[model samples]
Structures are given as C-alpha cells and as structure tokens.
Target: TLAPSAAPAASASPAPSTTASPAPTQATDPAAAAAAPPASVVAQYTALTCAPSDVRRSAASTDKAQDWIAACDRDGTTKYLLMPASVVGTDVKTASAGLQGGGGTTSINTGQWVVNVEFTGSGQGKFTRLTEQTIGKQVAIVLDGVVQSAPQTNERIAGTAQISGSFNQSDAEDLSNVLRYGALPLAFERSQAESISPTLGRDSLHGGLLAGGIGLLLVIAYSFLYYRAMGIVVVASLVVSGGIIYASVVLLGSAIGFTLTLAGIAGLIVSIGVTADSFVVYFERIKDEVQAGRTVRVAADRAWPAARRTMLAADTVSFLAAAVLYVLSIGSVRGFAFTLGLSTLSDVLIMFIFTRPLVALLVRRRLFSVSRFSGLSPKMIGGRAAAVPVATTRARLAKRPTPAGQKRES
Candidate 1:
C-alpha cells in the first residue's frame, strides 16, 4: 500500500550517513585555541642548546627592581638585557661556574657540564613573584646575544627552579661565572670558543662510574662478611635507600630542573659507605648487648635507642656539611652537595623506618636466633654463655718468648 507521494517524502528525509554530517558541529574559534599554550612549555625547552642558567636582576642602587638596558657587544651591536637588582645584599648571588675572565678570577682549565642555582632567603620570594608575573608571557633568558631560555611560565612558581636545555660544559660554566660576577656593565665581547671533544668527557664519566660501582660492591660484600645474617638487613636498607633517592631525583628533575652530574654520582657513591656505616653501628651495639647477657631479640630492641642517637648524630653532621657546601659553593659542587644531603636524608629514613623495623621482625622469628646458620649465635657474637677458658689455649697465647736467646730452647 506504498503511495508514490510517501516514497518521495521518505527519500527527502535526513538519513544517518556513513560519513560525517555536511554542516560543521559547534565550530571552534581558531584564536581561542591559539590563545593558551597547546603543549607543555618545559618539554619545548627539553632540546634547547647552550642555554644559560643565569637569572638577571637590575644594576646597583637603581630605583627600578627590573630594568632594560642596551649594551655593546663584541660584534659592535646593541643587545637588550633584563637585570634585576639584589633585594637583600649589594650583589645578587649567582653561580660561580668558573668562566674565562681576567681580574683575579681564575680561568677554569676544565669545562663544567652543568650548573645548578637555588633562590635562598628573600630571593625565593622574588623568584616566585617573577614566575607568577611572567605567566603566559615569553620571558627570554639570554647570555650576550644568545637566547638561553625563552619559555612562557604556565603557573605561579612558589619554589626555586632549574633552568633546562642542551648546554655544553663551557657554556654553562661561563654563564654561571658571569652571573656570579654580576651583570656585565654593557655587553660582553664575544671570543672565539675553543672546542673540546666530548669523547674526553665521556671517558672520564665512564671511569667515575666504574669506580663508584666497585666501591658499592665492596661495601655490600663487607657488610655480608661482618654482620652475617644481619647483613641481609643492611643490603635491604641500601636497596630501599637507593630506590628512594632515584625517585627523588626523577621527581626533582621534573619539578625543579635538578640534574645529576658526575659529581653528584660521586656523592651518591660516598653515601653507600655512610648508609652501611649506620648498619655497622647498630649491629655492633646489638652484639655488645648480646655479649652482656641479652637475647638476640632483646638486644636488637635495646640497642636501637643508642644506635639511633649515633646515626642521627653522624647523619646530621653530614647533612649540615652538605648544606654549608651548597651555600658557599656554586656550579657542579652545589650538585654534589645536594645529592650528598639528599642521601643523608634517605639514610636516616632507611635506618629508622625500614632497617630497624625489618631487623625487629626478623629477630622475632623463633628459628632466627636458634639456627646456627643464622649467625645470631652467642658464640659468634661472643656473648655471655659463661664460656670457660681453656688452659691449653690460654697458655699458648699468654706464654711470651723468654728473651731472644732464652726462647731458642722451645
């Protein structure tokens, strides 16, 4: 009963087609999409090359907090500079990265790969404000005519930060050293850069890593030999410590631009001993307590308080030394200080939170102390088993040679 008029009407009606609709649905404004950053700004700088970590402030006794000035360059051209004055001191603290300049400044014979700078005291507040003000704005960090970092701040930065990009050892060190001496009066005369082969640097890095690896292995082996069963706890603590440190490094890199250098690796290597030293101290305390007639479990529990004190004392000193070094030094030295401090913190965490608890748990197992293979034996630890002395054994050791000639008649 299909009518001709009904068939035509059905054909004219809109159909869900295999393709998209003819008319555009909710058209987006081209300008709006372009208004905000489409992708992350940090990622953009990930491949940046020769970028300087120098953050400039205005000149001395100037009225404006930030000022723009034109200065002469070696190429006989003018370049703009944005230098901010120091808020607290006469001179703003910049990294001493070791640059080539005369006037009491020693030339760095070797190039530095990376330099890290942090804002301390009121500088922290100033840096936070600068990042906030520059949000969504292109802020160019330049050294001479070279653009170091030109990124748009996405959010308000409340803490210190690291400048990122591809930087050679010389460029970074030169920039850091320049910043340390305060902004150039006008412009820097560009000098011919002496090219250094990356191969040499790579070789040095390989050597440093090999040494660190060997040291770590030795420490682990020594712990096993001396501490016996408890060495397992020490190894576990070290593993946990390393994991935490790695996590911290990654997080810091993403969050604040912290970079690990060869010096930083050395700092980490040094921490292996520091971390193991804590275990040795704790285990020795426990053994002493065991020798005083205490059970393995009881000794572990009682010795912890004293062990905790010693660990805290030693680690505190280390942390303090690292802090002072960070404050007083610049460039890669600061990186070393930072890693050292971070490792100390990790050591404390492993010792109290993980190591102590793990030992306590292990000792609680009934078979742990009873098994001769466990090495928690009273004889092994020289404990008070009321051990009787052997006359034969004592006599041999106690008997001294009668004098050179008299002793010949053995």
Candidate 2:
C-alpha cells in the first residue's frame, strides 16, 4: 500500500510552515491524562512492544521486525519504532504540495476518544490504500522512532483517518503535532538499549537545586554590595522573576508533563549572571549620566534608550542560542536549553515590569540620588571636574625667546 512514507523527522527545527514532525519534548497533561489513559501506562505499553529481546519474531511479530525498534512518542516510552512497515526503507517525497494541518480537535462524545487527521491529495490517496491493506491491523504513527499513535484500520478509510484510542486533548495535540509536520522514519534498524527514564533521582534533584540556590544567593549579595540602594531594585526584580519562573515551571509541568531536571536547574542558575548583567547595564548608564551632571530622573530617561537597546540585543542573542540548542539537542541538553530560553524571557519581563519602573520611582526621590550608599551620587560616579587656571611666566622667561633669530646660547 502506498502510504505516507515514514521518514526520519527533521531534527533541526519545528517547521513553522507546516506541522512537520519534531523530536519534541513531551510532558504529561493532567487534564488529558485524567480524561484518557494515564500517559505513564501508555508509555509502559510502548516500551514493551518496541523493546528488543533475545526472542525472534514469530507469527505475531513479523520476521522483518528487529529486536531494537524506537517509537515516536516523546513521553519517554519508546518500545517499537513504527516506521509504517509499508514505508520502511522507502523514501518519502516531501513537497510544498497540498499537505496542511487539519487544525485537529479531540472528541469523546462517541464514547471513544478520536483525533481526526488532516491530509492533502497524495496523503489522502496513500492513507486510503494503507487503511485497505492494514484492515484489522495496527499501523504505527511514529515520530523520531517514538510511536504517537497505532490505530487499527477497520475499513478502507476513504475521506479522513481518525486515530481513536486512549487519546485526550493533550494526547491528540501531541499526535497532531507530529502528523501536522511529518515524522516518518524511512528505515528501521536494530540498536540495543536498556530503557529511558524521564526524570532524575531525588538526590540528584536536591543537589542540583541546592547548587542553583547558592549561585543565586551569591549574585544577590554581589548586587547589594555594589549597587547599594539601587541593588534593592535589582534583587526585588530578581525575586519577582524567580516567582514567575517557578509558577511557569509548575504550570507547564502540569500542562505538558514537563519536569525540572538537574540540567534545567543549571540553565536557570546560569541565567542569573545574564539577568544581573541587565541591571548593571542600566545602573551604569545612570551613573554615566549622573557623572555628566544630569539629574537622576533625567539620567534615567536618557539611559533607557541606550540601556534598553543594549539589554535587548544581548538577551536576544542568548535566547536565539538557547532556541537553537533546544531544537538540536535532545534529553538533558534540550531541557537546559528550554530553561535557559524561559529565563531569558523572564529577564526581559522583569526589566520592563519591575526593574525599570522601580528605578524610575527611586530616581525621583532626593535620598536615592544623593545618598552615600546609593550608586547614583556624583562623587561616587566621579563627576566631571572644573578646569584649573595656569599663571603666566615672568619677563625673564620671555626674554629667552627673543634670541630665536640670533645665534644659539653657548
């Protein structure tokens, strides 16, 4: 049957143009899990089905099936790498053709959960043929060797194919994300591996969080010591940023099944320096204007243009690098990139919502501008000094220049 040739997903990026398959990082969604089968339960099943063992394929497991096969799910259960036995070892011609996302939606009204897939001309034709041959057979829809869905074809699917099973909204979305893009592994081979764990041990998690806490404290202390009163704003902004990050982490964990790992913690800790740098950029700009004799408020106003641009430029670079890293790297590395990118965004938010506004308020206060501990004082910033006058020399010194045209003194 000519079906969508299951080829390796694009490892570099989540194609913006279409729902191309991605080696996506999946987290469990509570709502979806509650509505459907617990994702963990589903994962365990995939692991066993795809995992390789000493036993060879029998009537149930085809002879061509190898011991080692990876599935398409990112939820950490990869037992069988379903490359559409029909499309295995074959090339899929990717096109700008009629293929597009169905804007899929999940429905449970029929008593069975279903995710309706959208396809174009070639896809529709191939899907129809596939359904015909695989009648009463399960066909695996996999991404990056992880299976997203394996549906039994009951009849010749003429118009559209709906993956019906333990799918909830989140599960449907995950499957849709892969199908919308395209995750087809053209070839399947045997490779040995034990199993995959989605999280680190408790001890590892504690150690990572402890290390990150220490780093953040050190940064806060440094900010206080150097910037004085202004440092309060710095620290406050950071605390607020931390709160936001924490909330997001928790929310995302619940929504998408994301869990914090040691690598992700490290990414957050590293972002401390990056966030702190934003404070310095703004503060230093204020100092420069103060040194030039501008009032603190005026300095703040003037400094914003330059400081905002600089901070944005630097943060943009960090965010882009993190995004690239997230796309290219998997597992822990991708986790790190995810956190780093998240923190970069938080840094931007804190700057606008907290830091800048607080700074504006502080600069308006008399004590803030002139306090000894304040980083904004003219003396502290090395204010511009007035020029000193020089006295003219005596007539005796002027007489020495009279012989310029005469013979040299011996």
Candidate 3:
C-alpha cells in the first residue's frame, strides 16, 4: 500500500542519496543544464521557494550543505525556479503508491480543462494530510529536472486532486498521459526521417479505378441485354449521374481538401447497382402494367406511383445506413460512407430529373407504339389480350325447324 509520512520542517535537509551520481544542487542557465542533462527521471514535489539568484550562488555547495535546487519552468512562463531541498520529501514513486485510474477532462463549473488524479481509498488520508501541511505554499512538481508545474495549495484535498491551469484540451490530455504512464527512461534526440515511394500508391489507385470501370461495364451490359430498347434510358441516366458525381468530387476536393481514397471509389462503384436498381424498378413496373393489358403509353404513366414508392424506400434504406456508418466510424470508412450517401442522393435526383421525364417523353413517340420495338410489348411481358363483352338479343325460330326438333322450347 502507498503511504506518506508527516511533512518535515521547511528548513530540514534531505536524506543521503544512494545513487552513483548526486543530483545537481543548482542549474544557473536553463539551456546549459538542459544540454548537459541528468541520468535520472525522478519526479519530486517540494513546498519551498528560493530566489533564482540565491540558488546560483549555492551551486558549489555539497549535497548536505545545499538547501535549494534550481529548475526550468515547463511552459516557459518562468525561465528559472528554485525550491528547498527538504520538501522534496515525496517523489512520484511514493506519491503514486495508491494511484487509481484518472484522466483529463474539462471542469463543469468553469469550462476550463483540467486533469483529475484519483488515489485509492487507503491513500485518501495521507493525501489529505499532505495538502494540509503544504497549504498556502507552491507545490513544485518537478519531472526530468524541469518544473512541470508549481500549483499553489489553497486548501486540503482528499481522494481526488484536480490540477487546473491555463491548459488547453491537448495540454491537459498530454499531462494526463504522462501521469498514467510514467516518465520515459531515455531522452529524445534528433534523427533522420525517411520518405516513402509513391509507386505503391499509384498501383493501388490504378487497380481500384480498373475494378470500378469493370463493374460499370457489367451493369451497362446487363441493362442493355435485359431491358432491350429501354436500356438507352439506363445508359443515359448513368452518364449524367457520373458527370455530376465527378464534378462534385472535384469541387469538394478543391474546397474542403477531400481526398477520394480507394474506399471512396468502392462506394461510387457500389452506387452503380443503386442507380441500376432505380431504373430497373421503373421498367419492371411498366412491364407489370403491360401484362395487365395496358398500352405502353398508359402503362408508363400508370406504373409511376408504385415504382416511385419502391425506389424511395430502397434509397432511403441506403442513405440511412451510410449516414450511421459515417457518424460511427473514422478514417477511410468515413470516406466510404460519405461517398455512398452522396451517390444515393444523386441516384434519387437522376431518377426524378432524368430517367422519369425521359421515359415520359419517349413513350409518346410513334416508335414506342410498335410492340416489336418497345421493350414493354405484351408478348415479351406476357400481357393478356383485353376481353370484349358480347351482347345477346332475343330471336324467334322458324316453325319447320321446331317440328323437326319435335321438342322445342316455347
């Protein structure tokens, strides 16, 4: 269990060190001290304050004789700092003996970011007592020989200690990470950076575009072979949709710096099926009307309402799925979802603006009236011939015929 002894007097000296090299008594220049560096990663908190000039004068004193250690401020708010030797009584290793989980978050009261550190229930009394003794003094939290912070103790704290400062979100998070995972063993040094070749990226882009192109060709081939003369409308609608999507991608890339990744291309490729399904619904509905013995012109108009509802339902499902994925995911997956949702919306617009109106105008042409030319022919779609109701009239039979029959109804 983690425990803390009572605070020693402010003037008391530190215990004898057992390490190979003794800690420096003073750092006259922060830059020079940073350059030479120490071999220790110890974190210390002290409650005494010393003037920068005073610490410099005591640099040559022995460990026992020196009463102050000079440190640099972490955030550069202060260039030099000093603290008494005795109050470095509790290092991080000792203070964190009963550390529980903690994290960085914003304060609800002030809306300022802060780090909340929690200690186990057993360490609650020890922390409370430590804060009480250090009240009204600055607690210098020194790490890697730099003063990370020197927060003043206003009152006694209990189980949880909130470290609040002029911290932005990122700063608070970084400090919390350091607290959770202790200091690094080695210091950072300058190193060379390597650049990656773009050959693989080019190959991947080529493969993705090739695959999408193949898929588009297959959809177009099937539409022509199945929909007959009506296939022209599908091809026309696809051309227009592709144009719109290309323009939008270019505009978005320029405006928002959107990059069309491989996943995004896949989304556009999948949208081929979505656009195909829309026209297929309309075409099949027309065939259904024709099967019920309606002319092509009449069927085109009559089939619209049902086909419209079905297409709306299908696109609605696709758009909702894309929206959910985009919201819940990150990185490439979000790019995929964004493109898919965009394509779905474009599909709906093309159906209303291009496909539907084109069919309406085409069905009025004399060429569409011919069963052999129009894909909605009765024979092709198995439309039944319209039945004609025959009227019957009462008639009188000849007398000779009645005699021959010998039993004619009067």
Question: Which number leads on TM-score?
Answer: 3
lDDT of 2 by residue, 1-410 (tens): 12221222323222121122211212112232124333553453344442233112211232232222333333333333222233321222322212123423223244433455545666555555555554544455544444444454567666655555555556556555556555444446679867756454777888988998898889878887888888788778888999999999999999999988889999998899899999999989988887777777898999999999999999999999999999999889999999999999999999998889999988889778767678787766654332324688776534455456688667
Off by over 4 Å in 1: 1-194, 383-410
| Count of backbone collisions within predicted model 3 | 0
Cα RMSD, model 1? 26.9
Assess the local accuracy of residue 180 in candidate 3 as a C-alpha lDDT between 0 and 100. Answer: 49
Off by over 4 Å in 3: 1-91, 94-182, 185-195, 383-410
Give stretches of model 2 more than 4 Å off. Answer: 1-200, 383-410
TM per candidate: 0.48, 0.48, 0.56
Q: What's the lDDT for all of these models?
A: 0.56, 0.61, 0.61
Residue-pair clashes per candidate, as listed? 7, 31, 0
Residue-wise lDDT of candidate 1 within 1-410, one digit each (tens)? 00000010111112111010000001112232223322332233232222122112211123222322221122222122322321212222455332223211346523323334444566556545555444443333333333232333456655434333344656656545543443444434568878899898788789888998899889878877876667788778888998999999999999999988889998998888889889888888887777776788998999999999999999999999999999999999998999999999999988878999999999988755655545565777654362534566344556665776564564
Which sequence of candidate numbers ranks them by TM-score, best first? 3, 1, 2
The TM-score measured for candidate 3 stands at 0.56
Ranking by lDDT: 3, 2, 1
